[model samples]
Target: MSEITPDLVRHLGVLARIQLSDAEVERLTGQLDVIVDNIAKVSRVATPEVPATSHPIAMSNVFRPDVVGDMLTSEQVLQNAPDAADGRFRVTAILGEEQ
Candidate 1:
């Protein structure tokens, strides 16, 4: 397995805009080496024959019938509105420009 060098750590630190001390660089290098080795092992086992799947169980569309039900009157719809104007609920202006 290849070891992570101090140069590599320094380069990574620079790219990430992080300033690491000598001790931190040494510690990170060892950790990074182990991580890289583990990733390499995982990559070796990932083959083309293993088909990629998102879920373990089969799924199908579950839908309900689209049917229009009871409708509310205009008075019932605007009953809870704090402010109503011209037979509609009055809301604060959303756009900067006035309509």
Candidate 2:
């Protein structure tokens, strides 16, 4: 097990721009030691055969057959528009006259 010293915690506090009282430093030392020990335990359990994975289950692409279907005519699409011209939808000018 690795030991976490008060001086290390004090230095970390300075680097992180955080202020820690003596009591906090003493408490954090034990806490940090436990965290490091737990990580080491996990590392020891890991093996070459155990493949690394971000997710638990295997995944594959789910897709449907590509079948062409009926499409709408230009007039059918433009029928609902408030304003249309030359087989297209028209809108008010957004830019000022400066251009």
Candidate 3:
């Protein structure tokens, strides 16, 4: 079991960029001590005999066969555009620099 003191909690808060009060740090230190101890016990039980499995259920590649589909005409593709010019969608300048 690891001891989580006020200093440890304060150091952790600094690393995580969190501002915690003295009272909050003290409370968290106690809670973190218990959490760390529980994790240590769990780690001890996880032995080499047990094969490491990333997921609980079996998974297979869920993919669809690549096949060519119907194509759309240039006029049909530009029909829904709010602003179109010269068979292309006309959009406002996205950058300050001139193209």
What would you estimate as the lDDT of candidate 3? 0.92
Residues 1-99, model 3: lDDT tens digits: 468888999999999999999999989999999998998887998899988888999899999988989989999999999999999999998888775
- What candidate 2 gets wrong by more than 4 Å, as runs, is 59-99
Q: TM-score for each prediction?
A: 0.66, 0.54, 0.72
| Ten residues in sequence with the least summed lDDT for candidate 2 | 1-10
Whole-model Cα lDDT of every candidate shown, in order = 0.91, 0.92, 0.92
Cα displacement (Å) at residue 92, model 1? 1.9
Q: Higher-lDDT candidate among 1 and 2?
A: 2
Output the lDDT of residue 70, model 1. Answer: 100
lDDT of 1 by residue, 1-99 (tens): 566899999999999999999999999999999999999987888789877667898888899889999999999989999999888999998988755
* Better by TM-score, candidate 3 or 2: 3
